[model samples]
Target chain A: MDLLEVKDLKTYFYTYEGTVKALEGVSFSVGNRKTMGLVGETGCGKSVTALSITRLIPDPPGKIIAGSVLFKKKDLLKVSDEEIRAIRGKDISMIFQEPKSALNPVYTIGDQIAENVLLHDEDLKNLSKKEKKREAWAKSIEALRVVGIAEPERIARSYPHELSGGMCQRSMIALAMVCNPSLLIADEPTTALDVTIQAQILELMKDLIKKFDSSVLLITHNLGVVAETCDDVAVMYAGKIIEKGNVREVFKEPLHPYTKGLMEAIPSVEKRKEALKSIPGSVPNLINPPSGCRFHPRCPYVKEICKEKEPELFDGRVACWLYGGAR
Target chain B: MKLRDYIARRLLLLIPTIIGVTLVTFLLTNLMPGNPVRLLLGERAASPETIAALEAQYGLDRPLYIRYFVYLRNLFMGDLGMAIHTPFPVSTEIMARLPATIELGVTALVLATIVGIAVGIISAVRSNRLSDHVSRVFALTGVSMPVFWLGLMLLLLFYYRLGWLPGMGRLSVSIGLEHITGLHTIDAILTGNLTAFVDAVKHLILPAFCLSWLEMAMIMRITRSSMLEVIRQDYIRTARSKGLRERVVIYRHALRNAMIPTITIVGLSVGALLGGAVLTETVFAWPGIGSFMVESISFKDIPVVLGITVVLAFANIFSNLIVDILYGVLDPRVRYG
Candidate 1:
């Protein structure tokens, strides 16, 4: 069974100019111990999907207007705030893109990691304060060690500023995984690192998730990273999931024209081409997106029906009129 | 550098700063048209001999450089010179009144800090809401209104019209307490004189609030904006996603990061506080160094004025030093060198 399944997730931001429909009918699922890559261009609601699942969108400006996030057979969107908060960090944890900025500057890395353990580990509740600290500290160091951080004890005592970007990201991973969460949502976790550091972080995350038996929802704009690390892939276009399938299958045979465009845009070392094919138009303004298919304006195979009626995910895999639809 | 070396370096800088302040005050006071010797002998100007003797005694007969050198020498020897009108050492006079001013200033700062931070957090958390609007207006009124006007208005209402409080002075007339720290409240508490403690607090309420109003507004505005900035940071998001309570996310994670700006404003406001305290003390008729300094300035009592200026300058420098230390504490990136 899937560990997390989000259906019809609609998140909007009420701003001064107008309502920004950031996420429109975003749906996907992460199965047990499976790493699903949510890939899209910038501002395509990849991060919003992660936040909506955890209910972490800043209110007033943004709200999940419609959604059902079923995790372990329970709808997370319908859960009480207290229930959602309890599930966050304990059952499901998240790591963000900017490793340095994502960690609080004032706190030691070890203190931050230990704090997560102390907050979520129920068995530590009955222990004495000293014992709890000792246990949490030990667990925090162990998490760091497991994430391939050398000298976990020393790194734990250091503040975020003292650490390199790679070290900080390792510590962030340690912080998120200290409680051994079942589901880990990593939102562009390696986007802020150097190219070499990026590979290391991706490799470390892959190895650690396997060791912990945790399912990952990896959100990134880097299709290369997705191809290397993800088991499944979901392609989003202007806040809607246009195509999804096993990574190999989607890479081998991209069904939607938008997915085909994205694949073509990448610089391939294996198949050298004269020039990379680019998409025709920019992403539509989400405030007042195209009425039908979000990608129809940029789709090479755009038809009258594609412009008039929004396409549904046919066969639970692709969304396009070119596929089997009301013809 | 080590913290001890940093503190030592800051203390060494204070010496040059104090000398510069004293030199400017000395030059300006001596260059003025009024004669210190003549001012001393008000009606006795009929006798030139008495004037010369007084001038000689006061060392005004010496050249400007020599007199300044003498003043500096005496200053190092803990002698701030004698006040012409009061016939008392300026140091003694200041020492007598310093505690009252310290008590008032410290009380006002503490009150302003606590209320300002609380109000700012509430306003930021409820941004664009009614409470935020109300606080913004309240903060504007506090900042724009003059200190003396606020003091008078508060006194007129609570003292004259409603008579709910003892509106002036350091203590009520009927309350007699031992003077240990010279701060009536502390002394009363130290002596276990509950009646005196209560009366002293009642007397302090109006002036302290009046003195704090402007600073409170400034601190509130800064804290609100700083908190607004901090709550948007990625770290705060991480804190929230850690399954910690909302209150913990705000107070522990956000507030600490937000305080650097607030501390900066607080440190910078010491000058405003000292200046405002003079107006507050005068309006309330509170017996503090402020009223004493006002009298000294009017009488052109150069020594007393110089003494107060030196004290105020030192206070400002000391507060800035404290702000630097606080910055290091709040953000680990700040390293002393």
Candidate 2:
């Protein structure tokens, strides 16, 4: 069975101007030990999609409009908020962007990891103060070890602000996976680290994921990261997924023009460029999106019908006019 | 060695700051049109011989800089000079009243922190809910109400209307407890006089509440705003995504980070509280250093006023030092020399 199956997920932000459809009817699925790479340009709703899975969307201005996020046997959208919370860190966990900001500065990285493990167990929560401390310490050390922190005992006692950005990110990944979560949602986890550190972290994550045998939802703007780490790819634009396929197939023969453009946009290592191949225009505004295919404005091949009626996710989940309802 | 060095550096700076504050209060107190001799010896204290004797005795006949030196020298020598209106030394009177003010300030501070932090966390987590709106309204209303007015209103409501509490003084003065600490509540508790202790607490309740109300509001608002901002941070999101409960997200991760701003506000409020105490003390008729400071100012009692100013400045400086030291504790990245 698939670890996660999201169907028509629609997250909206209710602003004064109008409701911004941040994630409009997005759908995907990942199997056990599979890594699904979600790629898009900035402001293309990739992060919003990740946030929607955890139901971490800030309210008042933001709301989940419609969708069904099914994990295992349960429909996550229909689950109680309390239940969703229980599932979030243990059933599925997330690694955030900007590792420096992703770990609470006031708390030690170990405490944060321990919090994830202790969250679901009432016994752990209800333990005597001393016992709670003992348990938290043990769990924290274990998590620190998992993240390749050699001095787990020392690091567990130290605050996140004392750690380097790379260490912090590793701690974050450890925190997410410590509960032995079945799935991990890593939202640009390596974006803030330098290129070398990024490669090392990704390698570590790959080794850990293989060792733990867990699924991953990898969201990034880096095509190279997707090519390196992910098994599958979903290219999104204007709050909608434009293309979905096996990572190698998609990278080798990108179906959507936007996907093709994204690949070309990646700066080749051979020569640093003065002007990289830029996607012609910015992401379309979600509040007042184009009538048809949302990416039509930026698409090199825009047809008349692409402007009026929105294209449906075709067979094999291709989202383009040229796909013509076919995979 | 580091902590010692830190404290030493702060103390070194504190010396000049205290002097500057003392000087300003001294100059202002001296400049104000008031006759200490007249206030001390009635209207007939203006004979030339009597005035000269008074001036010589009080060391007021000296030039401004000389008097200033005498002030500093006396302070260093453990003498805070004499009170013109009373037989007791300025230090003695302040010491007598210091316990009461400390009791009041500590109670009020505790009250402010508890109420402020709770309300702030609630308002931020449940932003835009009824509780959030109510907290916001309470914060604004609390800020606008003058301390004296609030004290009076509380006095009237709790004392006159309800007749549940004492109208003035630390207690009814009937129930006497051991005055080991000079603070009635502390002394009462120490002597195992629960009734007197309760009475003393009852007496403090209304005034402390009145005093703490603005501070509570400020704390709540700051905490709320800071928590709100921190909750939006990536760490909080990461916490939530960790499958941690909302309670953990709000309290453990968001609350502490939020305290960065709130601690700053707390330090400033401590200073402001000391400043605001004079008015509060007057309104409540509490015999604190604030009341003494006010009386000294009116009588143009330079020594007492200067003494109060130094104490207050020291209180502010020390409280801030504690807060700065706390920053290193709360956030490990803070490495102060």
- Separate DockQ for every predicted complex: 0.82, 0.71
Residues B179-230, model 2: lDDT tens digits: 7988888888788999998999998998888888999999999999888888
Instruction: Score candidate 1 by DockQ.
Output: 0.82
Which pairs of residues collide in model 2?
A: A89-B242, A89-B243
RMSD of each candidate? 2.0, 3.4
For model 1, what fraction of the real interface contacts is kept? 0.85
Over the stretch B1-337, how does candidate 1's per-residue lDDT look in tens digits? 4456665677787788778877887787788788877777676644888888888888888899988888889988889899877979989998999898899999999989999989999999999899999999999999999898899999999999999997778887777889899998999889999999999898899999999989999999999999999999999999989988889999999999999899999998887788788899899888888888898878878789888877777788789889878777777777544
TM-score of chain A of each: 0.97, 0.94
Off by over 4 Å in 1: A269-273, B1-15, B31-33, B43-53, B61-69
TM-score of each: 0.96, 0.90
Candidate 2, TM-score vs. the true structure?
0.90
lDDT of 1: 0.90
What is candidate 2's lDDT per residue for A175-225, written digit by digit as tens?
A: 877777789899998988999999989998998899889999999999989
**Cα distance off (Å), candidate 1, residue B298:** 1.1
The clash numbers for all candidates, in the given order, read 0, 2
